[model samples]
Target: MAVDLPGGVFRMGSDTHYPEERPSHRVRVGAFSIDETAVTNTDFAAFVADTGHVTVAEQPLDPAQFPDAPPENLVPGSMVFTPTRGPVDLRHLSQWWRWKPGACWRHPRGPRSSIEGLEDHPVVHVAHADALAYAAWAGAALPTEAEWEYASRGGLDGATYTWGDEPRPGGRIMANTWDGPDFPWRSTGESGFLRTAPVGSFPPNGYGLHDMAGNVWEWTDDWWTSRHPDDATSACCAPDDPRGGDLEASYDPAQPQFRVGRKVIKGGSHLCADSYCLRYRPAARRPQPVDTGMSHVGFRCVRRPATVEGTP
Candidate 1:
């Protein structure tokens, strides 16, 4: 099911948070319908069964892309989160993330793991291309960054979270976020999930959409940008239906040689913890390589209103 969102002006970005989300601005979006939840495993399975499509994580890496790399490291794999025995350096993300071979959507934990009981859970390990392919097959499109943020706001502009300012209001966990201490990876069980919970596991937002905050990071159509445009000083200068940065600007600065572009990803994953990552907010955003898929990343689709032949 999808939810129809009545679009209007809403403040985007945050000046008090991450540097990338600075200089809060206002944006106006048009009406559109978005999936009630993240695309579930069952939904993706149906698309694959009908279209015979294969995800990028299932295909072997091209040797030409890494001519200097070792042969053993050139296997099909995706980034999987592995908890540490105890607390480690929080600055180094490699302490918990592992490149596990054969860890596709079908085999979430590796070649041996299966999705037997996870049919309702949001599908993970989907690269940006795979998400676009699924959206095309479903006769839908990936929501733009602006559209996604607007919908995530759920009619509460400038709210800290999808539900409200408080992340866990009244000692109640509203989303599937990492709740406990960061060392041993313990969950508070407030959302009854450790990694990715079933879609709609929590209550819906003002727009009747569920899992808009935490579950899995969702892919968006916009490219990655270091910062957003400054807020307009007057109504006449306000932007409408803004896109994102260009392809050249979206590349990873650490790897200048690699020309692969990155797209914007919205919504924090269940791994988001208050001790470290506090991105489970409406204005939060991240950058993801178009060809890379991880265990904590997934996506949803959106549909715009139809237009007549001569209608403007």
Candidate 2:
């Protein structure tokens, strides 16, 4: 199911949080409808069955993309999060993230893992191309970053979280974020989920949309930018449906050798923890390489109103 939002002006970013969300700005968006939850395994399976689509994680890595890697390591695989036995240096993400061969949406954990009992869970291990393919099959489109943040707010203007100003109102757990402070090691499973939770496991926001805060990081249509543009100086100058920076500008300057473009992925995942990536809020975002899909990343689709009879 989908919820239709009468989009309008809303404060888009955060001024008090992460640097990337600096210079909170005003943005206007047109009316659109969005999926109530991230695309579930069942939904993705249907799309694959109908279109015979193959996710990028299931395809061999392009030789041009990984020239420095050994030929034996070029096999199909996806990044999987494996908790460490104990705490380690948080600076190095490699400690917890491993490239597991045969870890596609079908086998989320690895070759032996299966999605048999996870049909209702948000489908992970979907690269940008895979998400786009699913969106196309459903006759929908991935939401722009601005549109996504707007809907995620759920009419709660300037709220830190999707629900309200507080992360957990009335001392109750709101979303399926990391269960404990010892991230990359242990999860208390207090949120009743060590990883991704079933959709709608928590209460919906004011728009009646569920799973907007946490569960899995969701893909957006915008290219990755280090920070948002400055707030408009005048009401008339405010951007309407901003799509973020160009693809050329989205390349990771730190890794010049690998010219892979990145896209903006919003909404924190189950891996988000207060002691670590405290980003289960509306404005938080991160850059993800177009060709990579981790076990904690999934996507939802949006249907924009046609500008004309045949136009997007």
Strongest candidate by lDDT: 2
lDDT of 1 by residue, 1-312 (tens): 999887889999999888888779989999999999999999999999999999999988999999998999898889999988777888898988999999999999999999999999999999999999999999999999999999998999999999999877898889888878653355666667778999998988999989889889999999999999989999876688899999999999999989999999999989988888889898899999999999899999999998779977
Instruction: For candidate 2, write residues 26-86 as lDDT tens digits.
Output: 9999999999999999999999999999899999988887788899999999999999999
TM-score of each: 0.97, 0.98
For residue 291, give model 1's deviation from the true position in Å: 0.7
- Residue clash pairs of candidate 1: none
Cα-based RMSD of candidate 2: 1.4
Clashes of each: 0, 0
Local lDDT at 307 for model 2: 78
Worst lDDT run of 10 residues, candidate 1, spans 182-191
Query: What is the model-wide C-alpha lDDT for candidate 2?
Result: 0.94
